[model samples]
Target: MNLDDLAEKAEEYRARDAGITHEVRVCVAAACQSGGSLPVLEALKAECDSGGTCKVKGVGCMGLCSAGPMVAIAPKGGAIPDSILYREVKPEDAADVLASVGGAPVERLHTPTDQPFFARQQRIVRENSGLIDPESFTGYVAAGGYAGLIKALSEMTPGDVLREMTTSGLRGRGGGGYPTGLKWSTVAKMPADQKYVICNGDEGDPGAFMDRAVLESDPHRVLEGMCIAAYAIGATKGYVYVRAEYPLAVQRMELAIRKAKRSGFLGSKIAETQFSFEVEIRLGAGAFVCGEETALMASIEGLRGQPRPRPPYPAEAGLWGYPTLINNVETFANIAPIITHGGEWFAGIGTAKSKGTKVFALAGSIKNIGLIEVPMGMSLREIIEEIGGGCPGGKAFKAVQTGGPSGGCIPAAHLDIAVDYDSLKTLGTMMGSGGMIVMDETCDMVDVARYFMEFCMSESCGKCIPCRTGTWQMHELLDRITKSKGTHKDLALLEELCDVVQATSLCGLGQSAPNPVLSTLRYFREEYEAKLTAE
Candidate 1:
C-alpha cells in the first residue's frame, strides 16, 4: 500500500473509536485481569449499555497495578484526551464508575492521572498501550502503526535505515546494553545469503515482566520493529522467541502475525516491493537459560537449551549457522518510534549513552507495583519514591534490586543514583531486562542474597561448573550464614568463590550469578556478620 493508502487506513480505524465521546477504559492486562478486571469489564460494559451514551473499552496496562482492578473514564475524541483512574475497583462500583462517565468522577474511587506514577513516565515503547485494544489489528493501525515499516520499505534504502539506527544510540534492553545499530550492521555486512531476525521474548527473571507486558499490550509494535530490523538486515524470515508460560502474549503475538500477514504488512512482497519477509513464533519451555541468544537459538532448533561459549556470536553464526540479528521485545518495540521520529529525536530524549527510555517492571514491596517506562537519566529516588510510592505500611525503604538474579542491589544510600546503564554499573548493578524489586527495612539482607542465589542455582542449566556447582556452594554458604552457622571462614570462602565463579563462568548466567550476593555483602556485610556464630 502507498503512503496515502496507509494514512487512509489509519484514519478509517481512528474514526471508529474517535466518534465515541464518553468511554470507560478498564485495565485488562494480565495483572489487572488477575485482580478481577474481567468481571469489572463486564459490569462496566453492562453499565455502558444501560446508559447508551458511554462506551466500555478493555485496554492494556495503565501501570499502577498494585491498586487494580483499575478503571478509567475519558472522552474519546480530542487532540489531547483527559482520563481519570479508579483504583481497587470492583464489579459493584461499576454503576458508580459509569455514573461519572460524562459527569463528575467518583471522589472516593478517583486516582489523579497527574500523579507522578503516571506523569513521570515517558512512554515511547508503551505509547499505544492502554490507549488501544491489543487484539484489534485495526486499532493498532489507527494509532499510526506500520507507518514506520512502510517508510522504510517505500522510501528509505536498507543502508539508510541502518544509518538511522546508528544515529539513534539505541542499545539492547536485554541485560547487556550492546549497541543496537552496530549489531544490525554486523548482520547486514555478513556474507550469509540467509540472514534472520529474532526478537527474544523469553523473559524468565523472577521479578521482570517488562517484555511480557509489552508483548501482551502491544504485539504490533514489536512486529513492526521486527519487520524494520528484517528489512535493515536483508532477512526474509524472522522468529519471536517467547516463553510458553506467557500464553496470553503468545496468543496475541500469533494473532498479530496472522493479521499482519493477511494485511500485506508482513510476509511476501510487502507494499508490493521486492522485499518479502515472514515471522514465526518459537515458544520457550520456561527455561531461564534460553533467554540467552545462543541457548534460545538451540531451543528454537529443537535442541536442549544450553549456552555455548561466544566468539562467533549470533550475528556471526546463529540459528541454523546463518547470520542472525537478535534483539529483545523492548528493543524491538522502540524501533517504530525511532523510525517515525528520526533517530536524533530518540537520542535527544535519553542520556548521552543510553538513549530513549527503559521499561521496568516495578515489583516487590512497592505500593504502586506495575510496569513503568522512564527516561534513562531519571534517578532511582524518582522511580522508587515518586513513581513507586515507596514501600507499603509506611515502611522505611532499604534497597532496590535491579537486573534480577544476574543483577545487584543498591542500598538507600545510592537512591539518588541515576538509573542509566553506566550509573547502575557504578552501583555494582546492571539493568538486566528491567526488574526493580524494592526492599523495606524489615527485609533481611542475608536472606535476600540467599534468595536470589537460590534462584540462580535452580535456574542454572548446569552447563558449566562455575554456575552449577558455584551457585550451589554459594547458596549453601548463604543459607548457613543466614541460619547463624559457625565460622567467619565461611564468609572468606564465599567471597573467594564469588570471584572464581564470576571469572571462570562460561555464559552470562554463570558470570553474573553472584551479583546479588556480592552486592548485598558490599552494602549489608553487617547483616551477614550478625548472622555468623562467634568463632
Candidate 2:
C-alpha cells in the first residue's frame, strides 16, 4: 500500500457513496450518546432505510454539545457546514427530520450554521471529526487520514521529516510549549537500538475534555500522527497512554488499532515499505499526575504513577532507559495536516511563536459549552464573547480560566490579550492542554483559587514533599480565607507558600499548582483582603 495504492483505495470508497443522493449524519459521540443519540440514530436509520436514496450514518461530535443529540442532513459528499443541522433531536422527531431532508428544514429544530460559534473556528485538527464514522477504516482513508504517514514512508527520509516538522514551528500542545521538531530531532539523532513514542492522553484536568473529544471523534488521525512520529524518530513501537475514565475514547482507539493492523497500516512493513510501526494502548488509572511525561512513562512501566526530577528528560532517557518521544493527543492530531500541507503552510496560520490552532473545552458559565479549535493569537475576548457566546444569563464576565488546574485565571480587564504562549505566560497563565473555563461576576475569586488548590492537593501523588505538603497547606489557607477565619498574616503566608511551592516542586504538577492562587492575588487581591478576619 504505497501512495498510489492508498489513493486508489480512497477513490474506491468515494465511488461507492456516489449513488446516494442524500446522507443523514447523526452525532454518536459520548456526549450525544448520553443524551439518547443512539435511539435517535436507530430511528433515523429505520426511517431512511424505508425511504428513497437517503443514507443514515452515526458520526462523531458536532461541537454544539449543549443542543445535542444533533443531526445533519446533506447531499452526497457535502461538507458538514453546508448541511441542514437539527439540534436537540429525539426519536419521535426522526420522521419529520427525514421528510425535510430535501425540502425546507424543520424550523423548530433547525440551527443556523452562520453563527460565530461555527464561523470563528479554524478546524484543522477537527476537520473530519463530525463528518466520518469513527470506527470505519475506509471512512478515515477516504478523508485523507493516513496520507501524511504514507507520504513520510514513501518519499521522505527520517531527516527530511524532521526538517519539515522544524519548519512548521509547532510547539508541543501538552502545555509545555516545547518545540516538537527539536524533541523529535533529539530522539532521531540518538544512537539507541530501541526507542518509544507515547501519546499522553491522560487528560485529568477538571474542565478539560479536548483530548478525550479528539480521541473519541477521530482515533485514526491520532494513530496516523503516531505512525509519522515513529517513522521520523526511528521507533518501531509506540504506546497511547489514555485515562481509563474515558471509556469511549479507549474503545474507539482499541478498535482503530485492530482495524489498522488488519488493513496493513500497522505491524510489519507498513505501506509495503521498509519502515514498520506497532502501537498499543496503555490505560492510566485515573491519576492526574500521570499527565506529566515522566510520570506517564513510569505508569506505563507498571510502577506507581509519580513524576521524577528531570535533568535526563524523556527524549534523553525514558521508558525503561530507552529514548521516548511523548506528545499529547492534540499535538499528534496536528501532524497529518502539517505533513499534508507543507510545514510553511502551518507556520503561516498562528502567531510568530505559537504556530497552529488550539482545541479547547469551553466549559463553566459560558453560553456555548463545548469544544472549540481557534487559531493561536486570537483574543480572549473573541473566544469568550464571540465563539463561546459569552456568559449565560445577564451576569457580567468576571474571569476566564485557561489550562485546567495548572493554569491561572485571566480577569476581565485583560480580555484583549492575544492568546499565544508568551502572551498567556505574561498574564501568569500557561496553556495547559487547552481547557478554557469561563466565570461570571457572581464567582468569588478567593473561592475559585481555593477550589483549584483543593483539586491539586487531592491529585498530588504524594511522592515529593513540596507538592504534597505545599498544596495541602495552600488549600488550608485558602479554605480559612474563604470562611472568614484567616487574618492578614495568613494571607501573607499564602503568598509566600506560592513562591516556595512553585520553585521547589519536583514536577510540573507541584511547580505550577500555585498559579490560580498567584494570579488571583495579582488581579483580585481585594477579594482576599475583604475575606480576611481581624487578628
lDDT of each: 0.89, 0.92
TM-score of each: 0.97, 0.99
Which 10-residue span in candidate 2 carries the lowest summed lDDT?
45-54
RMSD of 2: 1.0
lDDT of 1 by residue, 369-483 (tens): 9988999999999999999999999899999999998999999999998878899998888988999999999999889889988988999999898899999999999889988
Cα lDDT of model 2 by residue, 337-426, tens digit:
998897999999999999999988899999988998899999999999999999999799999999888899999999999898899999
lDDT of 2 at 486: 99
Query: Candidate 1: TM-score?
Result: 0.97
**What RMSD value applies to candidate 1?**
1.5
